[model samples]
Target chain A: MNGVRTIFGREIASYFTSLFAYLIAAAVLLITGILFINNIGRSQDQVAPNPAAIPDFFAFALIFFAPLLTMRLLAEERREGTLELLLTSPTSDSSIVIGKFAGAWAYYTIILAITFVYQVILLNISQGQTDLAHALCAYIGIWLYGGACLAVGMVFSAATDNQIVAAFLASAALFLLWIGDRVGEVIPNINVARFIRELTLQSHYASSFAVGLLRAEDIVFFAGIIAVMLFITIRLVESNRWR
Target chain B: MIEVKDLSKRYGDRLAVNAISFKAQPGEIVGLLGPNGAGKTTTMRMLTGFMPPTSGSAAIGGFDVVEDSFEARSRVGYLPERVPLYPDMTTEGYVTFWAKLRGVRQPAQAARAVLERLHLDDRSKTLVRNLSKGMRQRLGLAQALVHNPPVIILDEPTIGIDPQQVIEVRETIAALRQSHTVLISTHILSEAEQICDRVIIINQGKIVAQGKPGDLRKKLNAANLESVFLQMVNKDKRA
Candidate 1:
């Protein structure tokens, strides 16, 4: 537990020290802000089309940006030849993996939090007439979705030492998970398609929570994905120690 | 303090560290001398529990490296070839983090003492990325020593430091011999000769020679460790 905190603190400090974190934050905020403004400008239904759209934008944006945040968590350390320092430490591989994953998750959460300025604007314009429950549910879903994506990206970061390869692999993996259901639809087997859709980022996050309905299954599904992904990451790092 | 038996490593088809064995008792500074890609780093990695051996066993302080790694790791301090560190963290912060990760009970105090011993107390607040190569190396040593482990494994502890810093590191290592067992790897033969009580010359993933530096020198009938090392390495390649 202490080892995990040490690694987590180091990774989080490193993120702010470089330009990559700043750029990711700026890009996510700028893109989301622009999308929010456009949605408000084009609003014809007075309630901003869907209260969930703001959080939805964040979940969608994370498909591209969250991987960028986590790409170097382990891979860049290997590339820079510092993984030797890290791996040689007495800490367990799981602590290192979880620490790094948590750092990236915290960073993405901060980015998600900053977008609430859009919600404030929406609420102010309508004078408390907005659907606060629906907006909260969507926010919760986005939080869970982003957490899962960060875990998946962290696993890719552990598998390779090349930062570019890690980044590409992470992005590709998340992209598949994000759109796996749509791709699954074309397959001939219904069961396989159902499994893919059920396991996908979009499938669990889009319907119930997005519209103010907190289904127990959606929450469980996202939590399971995060746990399973982190477990795989831990195993990957441990294998490196032995290999 | 350390033992290995038939330890080997394979990266795909190429054998990085072939089946070989050696031992280091307490209070010995065993210098691992090898050319690049000669598997010194690989062997060190295995001993430190960073990488697993393909078909062998490594024991540190009687604990199997594979089975009781956490216990083995807790008793050893490792400094890698390149000295990876978080550049953004202050020197104090960096060592403290390492202490904590290594499960030091009083991380703050351990960090302070190590930093002071390494001549880094004044620079404790400086970000590691901004430190010079020598200072960075010192910081690396500080982290490794923070836990006060009985075993120290350093992979080229003075790779990029200036001459003065190299001398300082050597002196520090020499002083450390009073209490700890040390394993140091270096391509710089003279550095090994200066500090190592004994030297192990590895080539093509095998130990070609092992003994005190002077004994190896006398056996080879060479002027210095460099020539003896060269002769052995060249002979191994031809074989």
Candidate 2:
């Protein structure tokens, strides 16, 4: 739809024009680059070397970085008062939410793609002994993990006008999803604890795809969270008129 | 054409708009005049379908603003109290984006014509953040007019603009009187007196007076609408 394209275009344009995108990109890339050079660079193993380590490192890093990237998706517009212009237009609420999600997802994908150079360099020097499929699988997991984190961050962004509050709330939310299984283990009902564990970020993505096993259900879980978060977000914005 | 009957908005217990009712037909420019905190913005928001009325109904071209919000909104253009804009976007980009969001066919052409009509052609490529307050106000007006909607609700369109820009904007609005029904809110009594065909004066969320500006002035036995407004509110306080 033209509405989707228009909103998504503006949202993506802002990511390039605003400093938040650059900050997140710089921070994530800097930390990842440092890890690539320090921990993975000094390895020569054919099995458990840099290829194996970089994916795990980036996956963990994205769990922390994606929230920072998505913290201002909608919250900053409310804070700056631009949400009024968007809301008063003839566009539907779902279009706005989907547009925003697509834009943020595209930006994070770009950032993730650039980090592929690290994999290339490690491959080039190692005579192509690296398991590309394994790395690809972890990359997919990271993308899905980032997507889920972005959805959670977007929900927090919609709940408030303060960017700092949104950021912290998103961070706190992702942290809970990251550790839900660990926290659930101490409970009385073991089945309930295992179900709660299955709901965590690491349990869902890393346990399966960390070793490059691509399960349809794991992919569905991340996509499902994104869909649900956006649904709730659209409903929240629509309710503002009534409230 | 617009009609609002017993429209009210209450935020938790404090009433913002209290059973206000009015109507304005096609080819009319109605001024919503009120002091600060008089629910002028709230009323405009309800009419534009940005906010729902607590109790009562608003119909724009016979479409209910609440029940038929999307259909009602499709025919209306709203400029909120503060011009909320993406500062990073150029004037042209901002207008085109708004037009497309409002479902304008070929938004690029609409944006170009609207900018030219608003006398913003020279600054079309300039970022909105770099624009002056007057230019930003014009940009806001340009976005509101981009879709060529039937009804235009402008909340304090002239607020904080320089005198020269105010005259330019007033002239622009007066020119728009040929096609679209305009609802303008302003605290500036003289500007409203010059531009509005009918004026609704609200005080404390209730309509205290309504008539042509000149008629209201003559009825209150005052020199201008400001003096008449003061007398009406003063009389209400004493009663």
Q: Best candidate per TM-score, number?
A: 2
The clash count of every prediction, one per candidate, is: 2, 0
In model 1, state the lDDT of residue A65.
80
The DockQ scores of all candidates, in the order shown, are 0.59, 0.68
- State the lDDT of candidate 2 residue by residue for A36-118, as single tens digits: 87755457343355454655775566656776767777887887667776776777778888899889888988988888888
By summed lDDT, which 10 consecutive residues of candidate 2 chain B come out lowest? Answer: B230-239
Task: Kindly report which residue pairs in candidate 2 clash with one another.
Answer: none
Residue-by-residue lDDT tens digits, candidate 1, B1-239: 88989999998998888888898888888899999889999998988888878899999999888899888888889988878777777899889987888888999999999999999999989988799999999988988899998889998998888999999999999888888999999999998998999999999888899999999999989999999999999998787
Candidate 1 chain B: 10-residue stretch with minimal lDDT? B80-89
lDDT of the structure predicted as candidate 1: 0.85
* Alpha-carbon local distance difference test for all models: 0.85, 0.85
Give me the displacement of residue A209 in model 1, in angstroms.
1.1
CAPRI grade, predicted model 2: medium
CAPRI verdict (incorrect, acceptable, medium, high) for model 1 = medium
